[model samples]
Target: MAIDVGIIQDVETLLKNLNGYELLSYAICNEECGAETYEWLAGRVEGILVDEFRYLAKEKRKHAAELRKLFEELYPGMKPLEFNAPPLDTLPVCRELMKTKELENALAIAMLSETIGRDIYRKLQRMSGDEEVAELFKRLAEMKEAAYEKLLKLYEAMEK
Candidate 1:
């Protein structure tokens, strides 16, 4: 379950500086990118992996939509900050895993990404000043944890 230490450090450093709003904005972008990446992978892969990727793609979109809705409710007329996404690529362990043709590697990457996301959401929850925002992040972190559990089971089955 080892991912690249450098990538993890870079992601952690980048996330450390973001405030609650910025973290939410980046999370929206991250979810969108994750959906896109999973969709791309679905087309490239086959069998059970295809279904899993497609499911993950859908889940990512749902997460992005939820985040967007929260942003609207919390920030009102303020727009989300525009910037290049820094999740999957900047934390390039997933990108490197993407290069591997093995379907099992896909599950590994997905599991690892969910783990990273859970940590990010937990940090955001801790940083939130508003009760609602903190609750939202807590729920999101739980969702990520659930996703990781599902992926872990899938990975173990794939390994067998």
Candidate 2:
């Protein structure tokens, strides 16, 4: 069976980034729950988010959609949950020593997550056959990189 090049590459991208995706999703979930927000059914919702992380790895499309829903709730109108930083399960290790401020850790995670997402988007943008989607990803990557730079400045200030 001749494979559709686009489909194959998309799958390849997913496979390549599966581990990172899970970790990144997990990180966002952890950060969301990290704060003791008594917003709705926090436990159940958080549980779902965590579950979605594994699901994304095992079933990309479905899991990605589910995770998007979780992020939609988390960020409301704006799509929060950066995709660049290490996956949630491994983010703690990927991030530096954040012994002091929880906020700092959160900031770092979000910053890195967005930064990484930008890079991925850029790559996908090039690979995408759809001109509009490619444009979207290109724009997204720029925005993410900008956000990451802002976070870097913030971190630098905090360090001093």
Best TM-score among the predictions, by candidate number: 1
Taking the tens digit of each residue's C-alpha lDDT, what string does model 2 give over 37-153? Answer: 212112323333333223323332333454456445544676444544223322332323233135455445545554545655566566655464456447646755765676677
Q: Kindly report which residue stretches of model 1 are placed more than 4 angstroms away from their true locations once superposed.
A: 88-90
Clashing pairs in 2: 23-87, 23-88, 24-87, 24-88, 26-88, 27-88, 84-113, 84-116, 85-113
Q: lDDT of each prediction vs. the true structure?
A: 0.79, 0.44
- Per-residue lDDT over 54-148 for candidate 1, one digit per residue giving the tens place of the 0 to 100 score: 99889889988998999999899998886585454326565555576877877777777788788878877887777887898899889889989
lDDT of 2: 0.44
| Prediction RMSDs, each to the true structure | 2.3, 13.7
lDDT of 1: 0.79
Could you tell me the lDDT of residue 115 within candidate 2? 57
Clashes of 1: 0
Measured against the true structure, the TM-scores of the candidates, in listed sequence, are 0.86, 0.40
How many residue pairs in model 2 have overlapping backbones? 9
